[model samples]
Target: MSGAAIALEGVARTFPGGAQAVRPCALVVPQGEILGLLGPSGCGKTTLLRLIAGLERPDPGGRVLFDGRDVTRLPVEARHVGMVFQSYALFPNMTVAGNVGYGLRVRGVRRAEIAARVEEVLALCDASALASRRVDQLSGGQRQRVALARAVAVRPRVLLLDEPLSALDAALRERLRDELATLLRRFAITAVFVTHDQAEALAIADRVAVMRAGRIVQADTPRALYAAPADAWVARFVGGAADLGGVVSDGSLLLPGGRLPAPGPHAPRARFLVRPGGLDLADRSEATLVGAVTRATFLGDRLRVEIDGAAEGALVVDAAPDAAAAPGARVGLRLRPGGLIVVPEAEEAP
Candidate 1:
């Protein structure tokens, strides 16, 4: 089914007792694009999704549009949006085919047409063989596919998923993530999914909107978001970059261990984000920092080395597996050019 473009203008959500769950936000989902709402729990990603789905009403002055048509007042049933939840909410009494055709049947569709559509969607989701299986008899992955087929069987204008892979184990989640990406593309449906897992969002979404507290802090393609975050929190949350405090002077940043070349002039005291891969063991003569290795762990393809007496306390680095540095060994660290991300330091509280 072709997808519809969705737009949210100044949408906000506030629950009873004066708790604001989502601040005023504006977003747009291109036709047939898969956008991911990413953030920690309590960050209002789900609330935003509910608003778009008409499961919850937004505060005043908010508008939701589908292909430029205002849908702010539309109820969930009237909006023609399909949704998949983390629970795989299927009817235990129904067979896989029954579950997939439930929406069509509820709308008084012809029996033969419903059957054909169910078979079509089941095949699309790679569940054609399980059409007659009972819900309880299916595996977790099978159940997930069934849920997806059911959501898409109705030819929804847009699809929404809330933590679709959160219930699966790590290995299964990884496997399903790739499958889900492929399915979303195959369906060519405008879809929005909520996820707290950064890897899942980055892997499955065409663009990711990173939320914080009650607002969307930044939204961009996965590669752009990883390469250049909007600020310190985005950097830390998106990729777990460590903030190393330092002083900027004469185009150099002076840290506890040593100084590295900086970009433009900034405040005397500044904070810099260093990704784990930014630091590497180098010859002493060309080193930018020196420290004693406190821990070394082999991570299959690479070695994770933690060092003390570096920037402030322990600094972690991803090194080549064959590097000789071990626990208690002193090593020189080379800072890769353009790896240091300067971010605004937090304001001091009065």
Candidate 2:
């Protein structure tokens, strides 16, 4: 299926009773790519999707575009966008085939054409055997597939998904997340998905737009964003960050374990960011700081160890499972030069 380019220009929406949602926002989703709108609850992800879908309109100058054509004032029905809700809104009375054919039927398609489309969708979902089954008989994952098949049956210009996988269990969600990612690529559809699941967004999306408090904090590829977040919020939001506070003096970072070279652009006394994997045990003879391993968690192939390094605080470090010291073992930290992420010093107490 062909995809459409989607763009949002200074979109803003305010609901009744003074609930301000989706502050003036501008984003462009390229053709044939999935862009995830990800954030915590009430962060305006859904509001942004609604603005693009024409379900809710932004005030006068807030423009929406499809393939560079202004469609800000177009009604929802006229926009020809496909939307899949979190609930998988299939009618209980309708069979799988019937549910898949609903959109085409609404467009006044002939019975023969509707039959052909339903079969095509059933083949697409690999649910041809369940075509006659009622929605009540299908499992959670099956229902979600049906919902996706229904959304794409009519060949929409753009597909909007609102937490489509939240309803499934952990195992199924993970499996179907991969399936959905493959399906999106195979179908070549332009999609904007709103999700609170960071892993889901990071895994499936071609690009992720991280949202915070009605504003887009950052938008970038998964690898670049995770490796180098634009700010502290993006860093912490993406994963649990272990902060090691230190001061820069005499052209080196003053850490618990002697002075070390600083990384990146920053002022003195900046917070250096390091993922657990960025550290290793420094040779004892060269080590200047000492700490005991307080805890160790074995995660498959690696061990996450929490060490109280120096007076600053306990730091979590990742080590090979076979290489980890026992709990309460005295250990020293070795910060790699490129592993440090430097941020400016916080404002002085006023």
The candidate that wins on lDDT is: 1
lDDT of each: 0.90, 0.82
Question: Please, what is the TM-score per model?
Answer: 0.94, 0.90
Residue-pair clashes per candidate: 0, 0
- What tens-digit string does per-residue lDDT give for candidate 1 at 1-350? 48789999999999998989999999999999899999999999999998989999999999999999999999999999989988989999999999999999999999999999999999999999999999999989999999999999999999999999998888899999999999999999999999999999999999999999889988999999988887788888888888777677788778888877787876444578888888888876789788899999999899999988878757888999999888999889888766787766655211
- Model 1 worst lDDT window (10 residues): 341-350
How close to the true structure is residue 164 of candidate 2, measured as C-alpha lDDT?
89
- TM-score of model 2 vs. true structure: 0.90
Off by over 4 Å in 1: 265-270, 344-350
Off by over 4 Å in 2: 257-260, 263-271, 286-290, 310-313, 336-338, 343-350
Kindly list the per-residue Cα lDDT of model 2 for residues 1-350, writing each as its tens digit.
Answer: 47799988988888877676888889999898899999989988999998999999896679999999999989999999888889998999899999999999999999999999889877887778888999999999999889988988999999999998999999899999999998778768999999999999998999999998888878998887787776666766786556666776655667674555663356434566666766776666776556788888888788888887542667777887776577888877776555666544443211
